[model samples]
Target: MQAQKFDLVSPEFKRNPFPVFSEMRSCGSIVQAKLPLIGRVWMATTYDAAVDMLRDHERFPQQAVRNGKKNVAGIKWWMPKALKVLTNNMLLQDEPDHRRLRGLVEQAFMQHSIEEFRPRIETIVDQFLDELELKFKQSGSVDLIEHFARPFPLAIICELMGLPDEDRPMFSRWAQGITNSGSIFSFLSMIPKLWKMNGYFTQQFKKCRVNPVPGLLSSLVSAEQDGHQLSEDELLAMAFLLLFAGHETTVHSLSGSVWTLLQHADQLEALQANWSNIDLAIEELLRFLTPVQMTKPRIAAMDMEFHGQPIQQGDYIIALLAAANCDPEKFDRPEVLNLLRDPNPHLAFGSGIHVCLGLKLARAEMAIALEKLFSRFPKLHLAVPEKELQWKKMLGLRSLLKLPVKLA
Candidate 1:
């Protein structure tokens, strides 16, 4: 298969990509495709193929080769001191290193598990919804992304990290700066932002050292100090990763899910009528609109034949989770949204070792937020036309710039 160039950032594809994905999936599982800024790569577009590629970590490693010729199709940023720290995060790690870092993070969560988070998350949801009501009352409308989706998890993550709620806006700015590295020019543009973000994290780490708080950041700092395979660089990376990873996708997913349900009124009504089906609704939402659309690019470990295609060592491969989630072979009605979808084995959180570290927490936030949102505003709806909604071109994620809604 020739490397078919599919400009990922093109507005045409970004607007409504299911048709494109359907076309790609119809061709085969692992299609030779090229992203706008990421050059050529094997795109796994089917459910079985995506799962196989993701699960077979040994054959398709997560780490890019140390000295591989990384052709930046988009923008490339200089790996400054701070970014190098961020690069050492678990998302980009393989094998023992991944295990160790993930173990530490797991240990932290074990001490403060998901069940413990529900009450607090629920309380936070109520407050945010109340605030949303106030915003609607004051302004007659609200951008859900800015007013609700974004703030809900930002506040939760801040509380988890023992960071100040007041600093959430700052965190969101840094996160947007970091994750919006979609183009070469945009990637180059975020250097100063990265530096600034790292400096702020450094200050926060120092604060944690002085008077530690009962949060994940303090625990990670202590782990680093105790010499638990957690370097200062990794520590900073983990801290940033937690804040960045914890909320970015969830915010987008929540916003997108709301927008999606509103578009499909029957699904919204069905879910609202039967609260027991929320888990199914969340599953369908994750699958139908997989927010973290694709898994990070994986490099082939060595020469191998995959589904009759030759993969050379160090070649990059991308698993299209969004496409897989919508595969006709796996989903009965791949294009439609069914809140009561059963046996939903979606790969929205990915698979194998590198699956999302905070899947449970993400589910909790989605479930709580959606229930409260729908129940509170039974007559809630989109303020603007659906055609006007703008999606950010973050390579591996589906994010909306804004989602205006009226809670009347």
Candidate 2:
């Protein structure tokens, strides 16, 4: 029998996806699906198949099927031309191009280099927690998303990007506009803000070229000025991707961890009993939560058989990372939220050369944020019931709209 078809963005899929994902897994590792706006896609519903698709970039290229310069299925035709600069980003490149773009900033994100920022991150967390505590005392409850989760990583990214302190609010606004790109209409709604953000980054690049300093943006400027390794558009695209991704994913990751920890008291108590279980606990949470639910469509480079399934050239392929993370074959008791599930190699940050560059930094930030939040507020928990809590209505991202908590 042919596999069942699903609407990737349906409200049913958004509410409780695991059961549906399990159904998808049973149907086949690769199930046919339709996404809003962009038509058909092949959703990889198992761990091995998802990894195979992600890691094999040669057969499944990162770049979308483009008609000369136009994207085959991207932004709408009416959107302004300025937003096209978002193309050529590292995540959308392959081969030497991907290697070159990723290498430019990988040094700064090296685990060791990121380790240097641990103390700073801790200090930031404590500072935010202090305010969050005050808010809890005054209001009797706190929205963790607004109070801590959002600002925690945003501050870090601002410092890393050398964004001025006053400009963080503006940057946050622009990022919200950019990451809310669920459909063509939503993206269309955000275009004015996107254009503003693009122009802002463009101006910053020009300024950085004249006056370089010690930060990722400055590093890009130095590389461009010294070796001309990056073009103007590439530099803008890199900065744009970093700003949106650096804080956005981390914010969702932190909030999702907190939400699940609060819900699963056993897991929460487990982590509290042995803080050393943090590393393992986080891995499990990442696997269980899988912040990035699905990856961008990786088009088939040529007509080929993918895992016994016939795929044609230019066919859209999507790896259901959330499904893969929870695959029963890959992890023992994948449904159970076991905090100490070692060897829990989840596809949260994805795989292959296009893997998330900020993985280490994200891990460090999440560790510190969760540790301090729990320690400071042992009785910390959800103010709203699980069903009442809202998840962002995004097509491919699993994130909370807000996490209201009583930090007493």
Candidate 3:
């Protein structure tokens, strides 16, 4: 198959890449594309192909060859020191280090442990929505992203990390600064912001060390007593990863799911009327919206043929989950929202050994939030037309900048 030219950074494509993805999918299951900011890479747009690439980490490794000299030069001049502290986490690591780091953090996100937090999560959601209802009554408008989408995840993650409630607002600001979709230099500017975040977390870790709280951080600190403890740097990296991954992805998920539902009122009504199907609704939403559209860059360890296309070793490949989730071959009427979808094997959370460890937790959080949201505001509707909604371009993730909605 001939390679399809896909400019990942082109302004038009970034604004909405579905057309480009469809074009590529028409060409073949896998197609080579050159991305701006980065260079040549392969884009996979089929469900089976994406799942295969993600699952077979042995063939396609997570760690990319860092242009160390360039990175150092850039960091020295442009990057903030604190960002350097937080960027060295599991997301960027591979092999023994990645395995070690993930193992240490896995205990905190175990199924039972996440289930134990449900009541707390439910309480938090109730408070946020209740407050939103009041605000809606007063102003008749609310930015869902700010009022609920962002804070819901931020509060949950902070609580999970054992970070003090008083510091959450600061943490939220720092996180937004760091993850803002913009130029590399613009993003690098968030280094100092992240550094401040790291400082706060470090102090929190110390407090946990002295008077260990029963949170993820405290549990990680206690892991050392069992002989598999992480170094301070590793521990800090784990904490940073959990916070960023736990909250940011869910923020986008919440926003994207709502945006999608607004676009498909029939599905939204179906879900509200039959709350029992919320589980499937959540699954379909995760698949359809695919908030985490791109996976970490994967480098081919050896030359391999993916769906008849030759992929050379050392070449980078990005599994486009959003594209694959909507591939017609995998999903019937792929573009239309269907809450009743079954056999939905979407790679939204990813696949294989590196699959999102927080998958269950994220689902539970979204399901609970959506259930409460719809129940509390059955007359909820978008305050702005879909065209007026702005989407952040250039960010690795696709999310609405703001979702204006009114609680009736």
Best lDDT among the predictions, by candidate number:
1
TM-score of 2: 0.94
Best by TM-score: 1
Candidate 3 per-residue lDDT over residues 1-408, each given as its tens digit: 444566554446544667877887887777777664455668788888898888887787665553212332123334455456566777666677777777778865552487889999999999999888888888879999999999999999888877788888887887788677366677657766766767877787789889988678888887742467888787787888888899999998988888777778888887888899998989998887787887877778777787888888777788888889989888998877789999788888988777898888899899999999988888888998767788776536777778899887
Instruction: Rate residue 370 of model 1 by lDDT.
Output: 95
In model 1, which regions exceed 4 Å deviation?
66-77, 224-229
Candidate number that wins on lDDT, 2 or 3? 2
Q: Write the per-residue lDDT of candidate 1 for residues 1-408, one digit (tens) a residue.
A: 688866555556666779889888777888888776666789899999999999998888776754153522223245655476765689888887888889888877676787988999999999999999999999999998888998899999889888987888888887777777777777778778778878888998899889998888888777642366566788888987898899888998899899889889987887888999899889999998898888878888888899768888878888899999999899998888888889999999999899999999999999999999999999999888888888887777777889999999
Model 3, runs deviating above 4 Å: 1-17, 65-85, 224-226
Look at candidate 2 and tell me the lDDT of residue 272. 91
**lDDT tens digits, residues 1-408, model 2?**
243567556555665678888888888889877677656778899999999999898888867644122463454345556677775588887777777777876744442378787898899899999899888889999999989998889999888887777888897887777667776777778878877778788888888889875678877766632264788888888888888789889999999898888878987987898899898888888888888899888888888888778888888888999999989999898888888888888999998777888888899999989998898889987887778887667888787778889986
Deviation in Å, model 1, residue 164 alpha carbon:
1.6
The whole-model C-alpha lDDT of candidate 1 against the native structure comes to 0.84
Query: In candidate 1, which residue pairs clash?
Result: 37-73, 37-74, 74-184, 75-183, 75-184
The Cα error of candidate 2 at residue 326, in Å, is 1.0
Ten residues in sequence with the least summed lDDT for candidate 3? 67-76
lDDT: the better of candidates 1 and 3: 1
What's the best-to-worst order under TM-score? 1, 2, 3
Worst 10 residues of 1 by lDDT: 67-76
